[model samples]
Target: MTGRNSGATRRTPAENAQLALLLEVAGTPKPGNVDRRRDLEDLRFEHFLAGTVGAGKGLRRAEHGARVGIAFERAVAGMSRQSGGNTQFGCLLLLVPLVSAAARGDLTPDGLDRVVADTTVEDAVSFYRAFEHVDVAVRDPPAEMDDLDVRRGEAAAPTLRERGLTLSDVLALSTGDAAGGGMEEEARGETDGEPGAETEAGTRGIPDWNAVDWTTGFERPFAVAASIRDDTGPIGDRTARAFLEVLADRPDTLVATSHGPAVARDVSERAADVRGDLEAADALADALVEEGINPGTTADTVAAGLFVALERGLSV
Candidate 1:
């Protein structure tokens, strides 16, 4: 029951989603992320491409009305087929629901909101299953919920079922925004914070801000999509710029996790300084690469954003 959005492009929603993955990696000068010319010690550009190719199966499943959790897990499984490991885990987290919403004939924020909210405990179980296939760089879960640690993978399933937590519930709990406005703070992520400290880690394990995107009405990616749509010049350049915008808006949780929050905030400040200066941006790109500071979460959001922009008719 897959459906396409009525628009100028003839490609299926699945094709557009895959193209977004390609476009995000192809964009040059994306500081701290694997791109046309950059590769982390563990991840290469080709790995991303291969991951994209494998991701199609999962994307198609989502388009055809697969449960959000099931589609995301399958997509993660397919994406893990490559040597790059978990190249697009966060991207798929955002894209699976977006593609499902589009196929269901409502691609707006409200529509996406409902899709995640409607997830079942089975979906949570499937999401945990995704972790078993790939080595995503996730922190350990909170202590009280050690039984639900994603690292426990399939072993966490029975606990999830007993708790009656849906995939959305799991994500919201992971972000610790279920009971506060921290979810909203993560949605914008550009506000002031300590330059030498990690942002107050509301919760430890699971993915961070992108998981927040799951619970925050998917605001950040859509906003980044708007930035992409309003920009000019080559699509690669547009993507590069949008990547920076996301970095500027928030200290990337991935960078924060591996490098510490202070470094992540410093990176965000650097991104803000890039503003209209591509030369400065390129310089920062070089520095980030040299320092091994990978703002992968920002890249994932940008990929999801690119998908949103393309689906809404941003052209090639």
Candidate 2:
């Protein structure tokens, strides 16, 4: 709690984005996720710290206006430099755009909307390339989407360009009900300069709810940030609380992929049960780790929320 900041000088957007990553992992009792007080057998607290440090270059890149996909790819590659296989892939996914918006001196939904609206085919290419650098835990894309499967990584670049897909276009394709797009619909700058105008794609692939952030003005992180700011206590407590709140609100995609969707639902129910009590959360944290259940995406959202909260000047 005492170490949330350095000197009194105001930090840059990139600096706050990086610190958000650290503060997220530093928070304790975030059930089923790695935190300062707990660790899984393979991934550890130190690994997250290392991943954050490694991701510094790309965070700066986003601040300097690198394309969203390119900056995200750079961040993932840098984050993989440590022994941890993919410690912060999702966190970086959520941070890049926020950092970019903050750099423009507008850390609001409107600012993020403008940045994502400018995504290009090249940005989509680098985004696919980013998946190659880490073993991200993603479910296989639906059989029909074989050509666009992220697992294809850079190999799908040609296809992406052929379809004129932007990074926003791809993410829009991942949202719930995936209710958007024609064969060549320009998702970039659509819907009054926002991404993901629902079209033909059905909610087919069991949408990566975590990715909804990219399409809907990053609504979840923004909501969680407000939750954190409105609460009282150490930053760690606020983060932990926000994590639980997010988990309770929805089934985590990673959890659904690892376990079953039913298990993911049960986990969310468990989170709902313990969210208001840090002591109960600590107890639940121990049980969840022992059970090998990790709500990874919710943790990522919490990190994203921390970034937004920091950008909004939530006191440490």
Candidate 3:
């Protein structure tokens, strides 16, 4: 049921509904500690659910498309913080829907946004590519990126803020205005420490720490889902879905993948293969591959491999 191998075939109604849920959840903002790993798992599940229920039997294609956009936007928003507002994350976000649409032969990412929000194709591409490693998503800027790249990301930060294009905005764009706006408000309140936001957290009614904690060790979920979504080679839909399910069912796999890069980074500084010190670079690519996080038709498998090497301090 994975879109990668389905040749962009229509999704089942349940899959569409689940996609809606994933978009909603991912777009909603949370603290810095929010678990992306779990967020991705939910998304994968939604995809699976949609297929299980049958398309047209439940959710319409348009409804599914809208929700898909929302899910992507949310992932971008949630991950943008770590992406350091770089094109890597932004590009990843922007590219998902376009890629998905193109793959399905139904929509182009740029065309949909242009029609829905009056955005230009160039702007949409720029916004998505903004996730480049030097952007805002990084917890700490990488040493390898040129100062100009770093500045570029910083400069773009204001546009994202002004446009209210948090990670959720990426998802909302697909879901529609109402869903996107509501999620943005939630993210804003959470970031600002608003009353309902604070009180609702850890309480029964709203999304809170409990929600975060319930989806513990999200790294594997993200890695696996990203890998499946981003996969573009010979893999089949069933294999891709199985990959994600494995990650969701066993959270440790995500952590394990994360660990490989993390450990590699720590041990490789100043080594002959200096390129390997770029853990974030490698980690991001690997996670993207593992989770199929790209928005374009082509998967950056080469980049993912490079990043894996970088994470491990290995010479490619």
Q: What lDDT is obtained when candidate 3 is compared to the true structure?
A: 0.28
RMSD in angstroms between candidate 3 and the native structure over all alpha carbons: 16.9
Error of 3 at 92 (Å): 6.5
Q: How much RMSD separates candidate 2 from the native structure?
A: 7.8
Give the per-residue lDDT of model 3 (tens digit) for 138-215.
111123322212224335445554555533343333222121111111110111222222222211122111112112
- Candidate 2: worst 10 consecutive residues by lDDT? 182-191
lDDT tens digits, residue span 37-90, model 1: 877777788988998888899999999998988998899889889775678887
Which whole-number lDDT from 0 to 100 does residue 63 have in model 2? 92
* Candidate order, TM-score descending: 1, 2, 3
- Top lDDT: which candidate number? 1
Clashing pairs in 2: 177-203, 179-198, 179-199, 180-198, 180-199
Report the C-alpha displacement of residue 35, candidate 2, in angstroms: 0.7
Q: How close is candidate 2 to the true structure, as a TM-score?
A: 0.88
lDDT of 3 at 15: 38
Residues 1-316 of candidate 2 have per-residue lDDT tens digits of: 0122235756877888889999999988988888998877778888889889999999999999888888989998898898857788878888999888888776777878888899999998998898788765554455677788787888998899999999888888777433222111100001111112221232233346656788788888989988998999999988888888988988776666555566777888999999879999999999988887787788788889998887777766
Q: Which model, 1 or 2, shows the larger lDDT? A: 1
